[model samples]
Target: MGDGLLVFDGRCGFCTRSVGWARALDRRGRVEMRPYQEPGVPESIGTDAATCSEAVQWQGRDGVRLEGAAAVNALLDTVSGTRIPSTVYRVTGGLQERVYRWVADHRSRFPGMTPYCESHPAECAS
Candidate 1:
């Protein structure tokens, strides 16, 4: 099986929904989602809010990294090889960057979007 990485927010409802969808689509079980906040994940793999919030990252064996919309597209390729056309439609690099920025800018409305800090709302930018 080809190794596929999925980086996501543990506390985000949307992120969880995406994860569930991934699981359902991944019939071969190629992709694995690891929350950015999960303990024991290597720093090199971006176990931090800034990195996770910046983009979805997919890391494969030998550290092949795919970021932003490409990461999401890679996930689809892992789960549904036949849906390559669909993945391409959703994951244009420039468009993905814009989407990622929008998500980060207004993350509050997102369910389970934990505020970055107990004392400050801005801290939960992850």
Candidate 2:
């Protein structure tokens, strides 16, 4: 575990669930998950509210920063049994990013998705 950080949008249900899925695979507890909306979180991570609103952010223990699909890939790399898919994701040129953007844009339309903020306003209040 490198104490890596995964900053996501707490207001997005899809994002929260997606992070849960990732956490399930993180048997080693290599990453620390944080909601960007948390007080001082964005500034602490050298990012801004606007940037976090647009995409997920990953900060490695070594200080490397990644965003969007690349950030997802970096998170995957921390988990075992993901080498094949991670490689495919990396080799897909720009396709992975396009796919990520599409999914992000339509995330609310996904069945069973509900923003965490909506369901847990007290915990997500800014």
Best candidate, lDDT: 2
- The whole-model lDDT of each prediction reads 0.64, 0.81
Candidate 1 lDDT, tens digit per residue, 1-126?
257778766656666666777889888888777666555443556455567766667876557777766777777776776667445656566776678668756655676433213223332333
Looking at candidate 1, what is the lDDT of residue 122? 38
Tell me the spans in candidate 2 whose CA falls farther than 4 Å from its real position: 81-86, 112-114, 118-123
Error of 1 at 91 (Å): 8.9
TM-score of each: 0.68, 0.85
lDDT comparing candidate 1 with the true structure? 0.64
List the pairs of residues colliding in candidate 1: 116-123, 116-124
Minimal lDDT window, size 10, model 2? 111-120
| TM-score between candidate 2 and the true structure | 0.85
